[model samples]
Target: MHEAEEAESLLDAGLRALFAADLPVGLALLDRELRYVVLNPALAAFNGVSSEQARGRSVAEVLPEAFPTLEPRLRAVLDEGAELRNFQVQIEVPSRPGELSEWEASYLPVRGADGAVLGVLVQAVNVTAQRRADHAMRRSEAHLRQVLDSLFAFVGVLDADGVLVEANRAPLEAAGIRAEDVLGKPFWDTYWWSHDAELQAWLREAVQRARGGESVRRDLLVRMKDDSRMTIDFMLAPLRNEAGEVVQLVPSAIDVSDRVSSEARFRSVFETAPDGLALVDPQGRLSLVNRSLARLFGYTEAELLGRPVADLVGEGDRARHEGLMRSFLRAPEARAMAGKRHVVGRRGDGSPVQIEVALNPVPSAEDPLVLITVSDIGERLRAQAQIQAALHEKTVLLQEVHHRVKNNLQIIASLLSLQSRHADAGTQAALRDSQRRVMAMALTHQLLYELNDFSALELGPYLRRLTQLLHDTFARQGQSVELRIDAPEQGLRIDLQQAVPCALMVNELLTNCFKHAFPDGRGGRVHLRAACTPQRRVQLELQDNGVGLPPGVRPGQGGSLGFQLLPLLADQLEAEFTLFEGPGTRIAFEFPLPPVEESGHA
Candidate 1:
């Protein structure tokens, strides 16, 4: 009787130890009707059932609400003697507090020592956060659909296999097909344009990208049922399950007919205005001419339609004309055509007069049919000359204002300096710091005055000057130290406001490095490196090989005003700051550099 009691005590101790093990959930069950023989308190509380409720009852009976898809999954594991393993399950209890969300789960089946089935063991992890993220994404999509409906362009939604499921009114009508007729049909089947192997390949890649959980938007031309081409902006995105199975697709189409027609009208007006229109083709043969060309050259409209536009352009400026055309081809879509260079012309009398030419290429049946619209600009040139002179006067006035503002800043700096010489020690120190800050920004404007781009500065040169300013401000106070800056080859252009934050940050960090990083009168080297990654994250690293930070300085924790302001500035720039503690302190700052659109002012 004593031996049996000892054996039972050992068994109970082992069971308790198993339940208390530091696993995700510690539980076990028997195969007989899937009854739970033991469960940890964690599992009990997770399912809101007690150990007593769990021990005798089958898993299905105790938590049917939690295991809606339990039976078949369990049988598969037992029948095959294989682990059921890491399958996800989601169930919505009718009385649960919120929306139903998919939760990930794990399961294992237990067998006897004889290798026979015992029961299935289960572990569940709530992925409600991930599920909520998915739902939030869905809500965002719904919001986008509402916005798309408000646009004038047609929109469409397509499935994985290329069946059109939904479309806005514009595209459906433009395709000249009733919604019912196109329903359930292959996307290409009713396409008014003939499909080629190249287009077939393009569509295949697009579908593959969408199925791979990526979204792509591109311009597509659809030949309408009436044989007219309609350009559309097409977007494709993925719809998938957790298992990565592509179930459906949502496509949006925006008809760009109005934009296309507007371009066409602009081309017509520019080419047919009461001026001679001509173009030099790729082979340098002047091939294009409008009806105005016939009237200007005293030739019949039919005769001059395909004539070498050279007939109206005389020989003296022919070489210049060709050169101008070559240069224009380099940037065909420049805001305006090339300046009206001299081109020779002949009339019914075969006379010559100076003519100004403005050539713009309009996309047409012939690739880039350049329209060399010639106007006798002798009068207009004089008028433009007068206007340009007036514009120059206004620019000079603006420059004078900048000059006056720059002088005012100089006056403020001089006033601060004079006051510092006659003030208390504390006031003197404050005035000197203010003067240094003013000089740093004053140098930026001085640099801008000599350059065209004032809104942004190159990282390499900017950093060089900034550190130089710090060195000049501090090094002159009988302080000896070395500062080094490493930056990428191509400059990272930073906006003016961003420049201030970046400079102030570097200034504070360096001041700390200078103040405490070295103590034994040894030369200290401070390293600064800035790089922009392909992910658009800007990484800025500052490190010193000195004796690391002083023990009393805890980086963001109970430090001075500079440390507190460092985090606040980081918050302003939306940057992440990290400090590594070691023999030498290393600090890294990285974040998405604000995009061009997010910049408030220059």
Candidate 2:
């Protein structure tokens, strides 16, 4: 009996020494009866009990919630002398009841010298955070796929082996194929390039280059599903892993076929036109002149190149025409000869000829080139002199119409303001809202009358002024709010169709913030940010740091007039509004900038 007691003490010492090494894993030892013989600090903490309480206690008694699953595994280790590796189980600790946490457990049978199972040794590792991370990663990947599917450009993803793994909706539509037809296939074999052998080879080379960690860009002609041939700007880029290895290839294609065709047509017209055509650079020098222009001025193309356009004007009209040319270059647009007037042109021989010139700026905003179209009105000038008087009368009438429209709108605004004074408070507010709406439209017309560019308006200054007007009108006693405008120095150009609605939207947003945001003389800051993205999308952000919105009041759900009109006006601009609630309220909207409209004199 003395020897047996000494051996038992030695076994306990050995078990304690075995668990002494510092590690995060929970360690425990149990007897054949599935009772805890030893529990280390880690294991004791895992069970939310003291080691003394766990000692000699059965697994079911200590952890009832985990015993249903744990008892079977513990019994198996004892009965079959088997070891279970990396078995996962969920358990609730007594210290934190009802909170289920996952743990990876390993069980091994402990044997005596006679090869009989004495107990089971258990090791457990917590994996709850890792499991949560895996779930979140799956959700993020699904979100990424949704975003890719919504894009308009053709996009495809290829594995390291250059096999197409996934593609967006546009690529499937462009190739006239389903997902199964392209996925898992070699990228070059897709319908987009398979029709052309040379194109297929080029794409294969590009894919290899991308896999080799070099990006490749090339223009390729592809036949679309509609049987229309399109020139696409194709690009392949390498997607790298954390180790900086190219793990995938991302390929994108944009159709530039229409732009190419348009450019070709313009080139043909510019070169083969019968009339004298000259493109004057921003520096007042001729950059390009057609053969007809050179012949009309009695000089070879080389001789006339780089000559100031004023050099070709006759002595009598030189100074005035040069000044007119400067003004046209400054703010150039398509304009015919004002009043059908004629300018005298001097040839290389010093002889003069009467010419009717039409000046227009190149349509591109970046390239400031003036196109001078010269028509020899020498013969028709005398016959059209009487018609010129009538044309002048029409010009004056159009200007008068614009001025009268602006005045009439202003009159309506003034009448609304006057009527609001005599009404009750609610009616006064309604009338005032109507007055502001009228003023927004009136301001747009006022700008049109002043600018004479009836087609579009500069939205940046217009928004600033409108906000200032709103602040001045609605600011109450003892409340101070700073209205700040954050926009690019170059203002956004909005067409007349969208200008009024955009102004009204700004007005509504500002008015809403002024009325409701600051209550009982509270002061804060309001910011109006407007900018145009490189993708030609307009972004508008109106933020105010004041009392946040009501708990559940959303944009389209509010009952006030401002809320009703705000969404309606945003719809008119084709913009989607999103509301962000916080210590303040932020309303943001982004929409594609309206395409530049091609128009003529109305």
Candidate 3:
């Protein structure tokens, strides 16, 4: 009986040691009333209490926040001898208030000697971190799926065997098919390439290559949703793993139908162009030549390609042509090659071909290229030479006509002078006036012929000469009259239409100043000024410091021919003729300059 007592004490001590063992999992024992009977340090800490404080406390008192959930399960284990394994629960504890933590727990009934349940044993593990990690991974996968589906290009993933597993939204919608239509099928059996058996076979091979870590790309023709063919820039590449092994195949494609069509159109236009066209590289070598250019140089397109451009030029001009080509490549722009001059090229037969060349620079990001247009101008040059010769003959004939006109006027002036010698004084004055007028017209023709331009003559020099002639004709031997003329150094010019009338008007006005202004050998100074106005008209002013005009003697109303001719000539020129009241007669007039097309060189 003493030994039995010692064993009972030892057994109690062993039960206490077992419950005190340090472990990460929480352990506890509850009585039939759901009161704490035995609690480990971990289980007491999970309830926010010490073991000594919780040993005799009810579970509702120690963990009030979790009592509602734990009481039912604890009661089941104690009264019905039920056992639970791996049951998951979410609860709040005193240690972390208002925050839920996840736990996985198991409960087993503890039986007495009569097989009746005495208490419940509990085991629990915290699984909050693992649960949170799993939730985050699911969110990331959803985002990645959204991004892949939003792309415009056709994109897909295939297994190592080339069976399609995933496809993006763009290509699926473009073909008016759902993902289920193509997914799980072999890549070559998809709607895009299945229409062409040969293309499908090629695609199968390409997929195999991609699976072997090879990248394949090509421009391929594929059937579209409308059953029409379209061109695509397609690529198949391997998706590799960390070990550098090809794990999956990735297929991508972009629609390139418009680009292919544009290239075809450009080729057609280039081959059928009428002008001789050639493309020259920065090195002055012919990179490409059209049919027209090959024919012009008497060489086939293949024969001209890669040939130096200078080789086509005549031997004498080859060196100069090469230098020009180099200069053009340095600073390229669109321009004529030789201006108006013809370039001489040597044909394949060694014959000379006169041609006009135009140069245009093609834009490039790498090296400069020149587009040269060669035109055979042999016939054109011949036509131009004939035109120039004919023009020269016509000029000579016009000059002769002007010389004859001047001679006839001189004859008339001589005849009038002879008549003046035999007439009365009044009649002699009239005859001399007519002769002077004839001389003025004759001088204009004489200047035109001398200048070899019948279009126009210098007004300043013509006026100076005419005035000097008048001064010589009218100035008396004892008279001391002074003459002053002001004009531009380069001289103002008027066409024949205005020049003839202007000369006649000046002759009349100056004759009046010489004949009527100073009388009986009374000497005076005469000034004539000519200038261009700001309004682009010509301004002329004739002033004299001689006896003023008589009262009431208005110009153009007088009976004399000179006065009568002034207004008529002014009317013909459409000029503004004004007579200012001053110390002497001041006559001013202005007329519009000819349009640029009608104006001539001075």
Best by TM-score: 3
Higher-ranked by TM-score: 1 or 2: 1
Worst 10 residues of 2 by lDDT: 332-341
- Please report how far candidate 2 places residue 443 from its true position, in Å: 0.7
**Candidate 3 per-residue lDDT over residues 423-466, each given as its tens digit:** 99999989999999999999999999999988877788888998
Tens-place lDDT per residue, model 1, 250-365, is 76677777878887997697567787766667554556556676676677666665555555667776666667667776666673555656666766568775577777766553
Q: Per-residue lDDT tens digits of candidate 2, residues 416-479?
A: 8899889999998888888888888878877776776767767787787778778888664345
| Cα-based TM-score, every candidate | 0.43, 0.39, 0.65
Comparing candidate 1 with candidate 3, which one achieves the higher TM-score?
A: 3
Give candidate 1 regions above 4 Å deviation.
1-290, 295-311, 319-407, 519-522, 552-560, 594-602
Pairs clashing within candidate 3: none
Best-fitting candidate, scored by lDDT: 3
Q: Model 3: how far is 376 from its true place, Å?
A: 0.6
> Arrange candidates by TM-score, highest first: which order?
3, 1, 2
* Number of colliding residue pairs in model 1: 5
- List candidate 2 stretches off by more than 4 Å: 1-375, 379-398, 476-478, 489-491, 597-602
